[model samples]
Structure formats: structure tokens, C-alpha cells
Target: MLSILKDFLLNLFFILIPIFIVPIWIEEKNIPKHIKRHLLTVCFALVIILCMTIPVDADREFISDLRQIPLWLGSLYKGAATSMFLCLVTIGYRSLFGGTGFFVTVIISLFIMVIGIALEKKFLALSSKHRVLLATALCTFSGILSIVLAQTFHRIPLSSDISLAYLSVQPICMLITCSLKEMIYKNIALRKRIIRAEKMEAVSHLAASISHEIRNPLTAARGFMQLLEQHHLSPEKRKQYVRIAIEELDRAEAIITDYLTFAKPAPESIEKLNVKTEIERVIDLLRPLANMNSVEVKTTLAPFTIIGEREKFRQCLLNIMKNAIEAMPNGGVLQIYVSIEKQHVLIRITDTGIGMTKEQIERLGEPYFTTKGIKGTGLGMMVVYRIIESMNGTIHIKSEIHKGTEVSIYLPLSSNLHDLTNEEKKLFMAL
Candidate 1:
């Protein structure tokens, strides 16, 4: 009888040690909650080990003969139950915590397990830390109590068998729980990034709408102010005041025009067109402005096609080119390049002009963000941003104070274009 008791104790150790150690090692890097859940699962697995090995019908003569069943089979059953329980626990924890406080929860759980283990051993006569830890502790103590009662009363303990089975299977359950936690955290982070991008797009659209509505009236007002300047007036006295009024109106109109351009709706006439042609058109349009400032235009065009609205695309090029010309008031080379890659069209615009600081580049395309004073509406880059986004493209800007600036645009070769309705198409045709 002593030998049988020794063998049972040895079997318990062999079953429980790996179940505890393996999960701890596997989850070494995991945060506290994950570790806690995993540890709890290991404990719950101990119940399965207890049910499988403990002689359920020790009073029945035939049942004692069944001890020859392989010990490994019992271990495997314990592992499986632990795995299932861990999965359930992980799901529950994730729902409660939303993936935060993993480390904190794990530490608390470990403390609880330690305390629970000591209590179970003191009051309930369960041996081994594995039996008293996490979920396994509850099952192990309950099983032991049932076993003791059955022996004292000389009665069969049928319920104890089921409890023991569940107790042995904690390890497998914890592993499943940890995996679910990781998946939930990853999904939440991805969703946050998507929401941020959507907000940026909405801001760009609002800026564009405001600019468009205010521009035409501002231009007419400025034109009327210029006409008023032509009226006969006292040569010296009224001349200074009139000139100041005209200049102020001109500045206001320029600001309104810049805002309108930045907020203008993307033209619907997008088509597969040569990027080189677009760049050349922008250079030609900006030549008078550049020559007036003595800035030189240079080009290195590689044959590539991009599908986007012609007018909106033109505006993007024009804004960057105009900024470059204004930067090099004393004359500088404005280099434009168009190149093709496997799935994208790349446009690189570089200028040897007064450059901006890192902070300016970082804040580029933000609405009403500018460095050009009253001459800048801070909407140029914002407009460029909206057009590129509407075309499902990306823009990257790099600059260093007194060095120069380079803006690169990456446009996908195949864009998902929304076909215009009949009325929209007719409006485009009219324009």
C-alpha cells in the first residue's frame, strides 16, 4: 500500500511539472494578464491529471487492474483539457480588459495563485503547487474532498471523476487565451490608424470648399477696387490713401484666391496621361513668373502615365512649382523628374532655393499652415494633398533650412475611379 501511494504521488509530479513549466516558458515575454491566464490554465489542467490517474473505483476489484493503462495517455488528456480552459479564460479577459493592463493582471493573478495554493495545501490536503494554482486549485481541492468523503463513508464518488478530468487540463486552455489577446490588440491599433487618416481627409475637403466659395467674389471686389483707383482724385492727398486701400484689397484677394485654389474640387476629367506632359505644361505656365524672379526651370522626364483629373493634377504641379520659383527670388534651378516603377508613377520636384526647416516640412499640407506670410494662404499644399488623396496617391516632402526642398509624389498605376453619373458627365462636358 505504501508503494502504491508513492507511485501515485510520482505520477502526479510527472503530470503536473511540465504543465506548469512549459506555459511559463512559452509566455515568458507575454504581459502580466497573458502570463496570469496561462498560469491559471496550467493549474486548471491539473484537475484532468488527477481524474485520469486517481483510481476512481478502488473498491471495485476489476477497476484496480486498469492501472496498467499508459501514463502518457493520462498526461495527454490533462494537457488537452488545460488547453481548452486557457482559451476560454483568454476570451473572457480580453472582453473585460480590451487588451490593456496585461502585465498588471498577470502579476495579481500570480499572487492569487500562490495564496490559493498555500490555502489548498493547508486545509484541503492537496500536494504540489500545480494542483493549487489558477483554475486547477479549485478542481484539485474539490476532487480531494470527494475522495476523502468516499473513503470515510465507504461510498462510490462518481462526480469526483469528472472534476478530476477538468482539473488536469489547464495548460492547453491558457495558451488559447494568450493568442486571442494578441489578435484583439493588433485589430484595435489598425482601426485607430484608419480613423486618423479619415479625419485628415475630411479636414482637407472642408478647406477646399471654403476656398472655392470665397475666391470669385474676392476677385470681383479686387477688380472693382482697382477701377476705383482710376477715378480722378486730389493728386497727392487722396493718392496715398487710395493706393493703400488698393494694396490692402489686393492682399486680401490674393489670400482668398489661394484659399479657393487649395479647397477647389478635383476635376472629374481624370484619364491615363503622360506625367512628363503634365510637368512641362506646369513649367510653361510658371515660366513668366520664374523669369520675372530670374529662376531657371529644368526637367528630366521619364515616360510614365498616371490616371488623375487633368486640372486638379495641374494645380498640384503648379503650386509646388510656384513655391519653388518664389523661394529662389535670386534665381535657382527648379528640377522636375517623372519616372515609372513596377506599380507606381513617381514625380520628384526639387528646387535650389530658400528651403524650410524640418518642422515646416512635417506640417506641410495641413490647412492654413504656411511660412510665406501674407503672400501665403497656407492652403496650397492642403489643396495638393486633397487632389492626391482623391486620386489614391501619396506625397512625401523633405526640406532643410538654407539647403533646399524636394517633394515626391507616388501615384498608383491603376486607380479605382468612380464613374460619373449622366448629369455629372454632362456638367464636365459643358466645362
Candidate 2:
């Protein structure tokens, strides 16, 4: 019994090593998640096959080797397709060996896959103590039965005491694995959350500093520009100078507004705003700039109602649309679409422009990060992100290097922002 327990611990440790080894090969956010998923699945399968070659000997009979760990984990986390592949591999590997318990291996392997798929969600929700016990119980029964069937049908010699050792050791091994997995993952999650909180704190501080440091000078410059407009010389020259001054001042004001907005929390102003009307107004405001850049602006705006401040919504649309228009230096089509979905309003903006890389997209809402070098203050999109978040809405931006960019925003059709239940709020935030 002592020897069997020791082997069980050793077997499970080796099985888990391949799983934990994935962190070294694939860092979070470094590779696309789907690719990482596939790679990890392959790695876990390889480890399982390797473990299958080394079985625990009980009175010179097979008892345990942690064969079920990969099968069960792959199903629970990697989903059906990967789990099915693992099942096939396990069956094939056992058949290739073809010593004894072949039929029992195939039957129990099939049972594991079936149970894994059926109980994945319920099992995940279980407490660690219960989850480990339940899973371990199933694996233990199948393992002991495999030994029994081997002795009965395949004429392999086995002892009853060895089966008892399998029963005793399997649950202990599973409990240890479960505890370690939960602890490691929880620590990782906590670390990520702490990093995120720190980043947000830094953003708030920077926004405050920028707003206070630059706003007054920008206001003074704008006022001087307004005074100069009164004592004009030539119509064309005055117009050009005034235009340049005002444009520069407006740029300064935009930067100031972006930071100020970030530093402050949004006020509670909930009203039923017409999405189509507000969007049309923004399009009109940007028509001249769009025309100047030779970029065509077209919209398929459906009448949709959402709870938000009208000016805030207008400002949000203006910043986003302006960014879209500017993306097309050589001019391209900027398309806007608004539609009503189940309980929300959907606004999608697509621009045929230079587009952005994956890294640029990931860095979109950072305080000082900018895709456009000198021309961008990086706050336009930052303000856009804040507005959407405060409105209890969500935004998704997809871009390719040269193909183009598409941004989709979803806002719930509620009486007020506070009306959103926790679940609905999560839905929008997840969007």
C-alpha cells in the first residue's frame, strides 16, 4: 500500500509537469489564445502518452499511472474537439501496446470522455474538495474495474489487495493535483488584477497632471486668437492666420478635454436619446473635414433609443469618427451603421484606411499611447473608451495592417445607466 501510494504521487507529478511547462513555452498575450490552446493540448497529450508507457506495478499487476488526468483536464478546459482527439489517442496508444485490459481500457476511456463532456460545467462549479473526490472516485472505479476485467477475461494475474491500494491512492493524488492547480491559477489571476489596478491608477494621475498643466495656457491662446480676428489685415491672409490659430487652439483644447474627462468621473445624466439623430448631427459636423480629406462618409442610421447624455454621445461619436476620417490620409470610405438588437443598440464604424497592427490595437486606450505619431495626442480614443464605459456600453476594435479597421459599440436600451442588472452590465462589459 505504501509503495502504491508513492508511485501514485510520482505518476501524477510527472503528468502535471507537462501542463505547468506550458507557461514557459507560451506567455499570456504573446500568442493568439487559440494557437496557445492547440499547442498546450498537444503538449498535454504527449505527456499523457509518455505516462502511459510507465504504469504502477501492484504485486506485478497494473494498478495506477495517472492516465486519466490529461483526458479529464483536456475535456474540462479545452472543450469537445480537443477532448475527442485525446480520447482517440489514448485508445490508439493502449491498443498498440495490446498486452491485457485492452477492452477495459477502450471501454473506460470512452466512459471518461462521455462523463467529462456531460459533467464539465457542474464539475467546474464544484468546490475543490468535492470536485477532486467526485473525479477521483470515478477514475478509481474505472481503474479497479480495468484490473478486475483484465484478470477475468484477459487471464492476467492480479491481487485484490492491489485493487484496494488503487482505490486508496487515486483520491489522494487527485486532491493534491486539484489543490495545486487552484492555488497556482488563483495567484496568477490575482497578479493580473493587481497589475490592471496599478495601470488604471497611473492613468488617472497622468490625466490629472496633463489637464491642470496645459488647459490654462490653451484657453489663453484661444482667447488671443479670438482677439486677433477682430484686427484683420487682408481677407485671405487674416482668414489663413485665424484658421491656423483656431486649429491649433482647438487641438490644444481637445487634448485638455481628453485628460480632464479621464480625471473626472461621469455625471449621472440619463435621458432617452435618439441614436440616429445624434449620429446624423455628428456626421454633419464632420462633413467638411471628411470632404477636405476626400474621404466619403456614409451612414445607415436606424432610429434607436439608448440611455445617455446627448452631448456626451455626440462627443463620443465625434472623436471616433474624426479618428476614422484622419486614418485615411489618402482618402477612403468611412461607413457607419446603427441598428437595434434584442435589448441593446449597436453602432458599427468601419474605415478603409491604413489600419493598425495587433499591438497598436491592444494599446488603444492607454493614456499616452498613440498609433498616429505627432498628429495624435492619444486621448481621442481614450475619451471614447471612457464615454462608452461610463454609459455602460462596450467597444470592439478590429484592424489589420493595411486592410482597414472596424469598431463596434453596443449600448443597452435602459431607462438609466443604473437600471442595468449585474448580469446585463457584465454582458456589455464583456462585449
Instruction: Give the candidate number with the greatest TM-score.
Output: 2
RMSD of each: 15.5, 15.2
What lDDT does each candidate get? 0.57, 0.75
| Candidate 2 lDDT for residue 336 | 98
- Write down the TM-score of every candidate: 0.47, 0.50
After superposition, candidate 2 runs with Cα above 4 Å error = 1-6, 58-64, 125-130, 154-161, 222-431
* Candidate 2 per-residue lDDT over residues 349-382, each given as its tens digit: 9999889998999999877678778677877788
TM-score of 1: 0.47
Residue 336, model 1: lDDT of 89
Per lDDT, the best of the predicted structures is 2
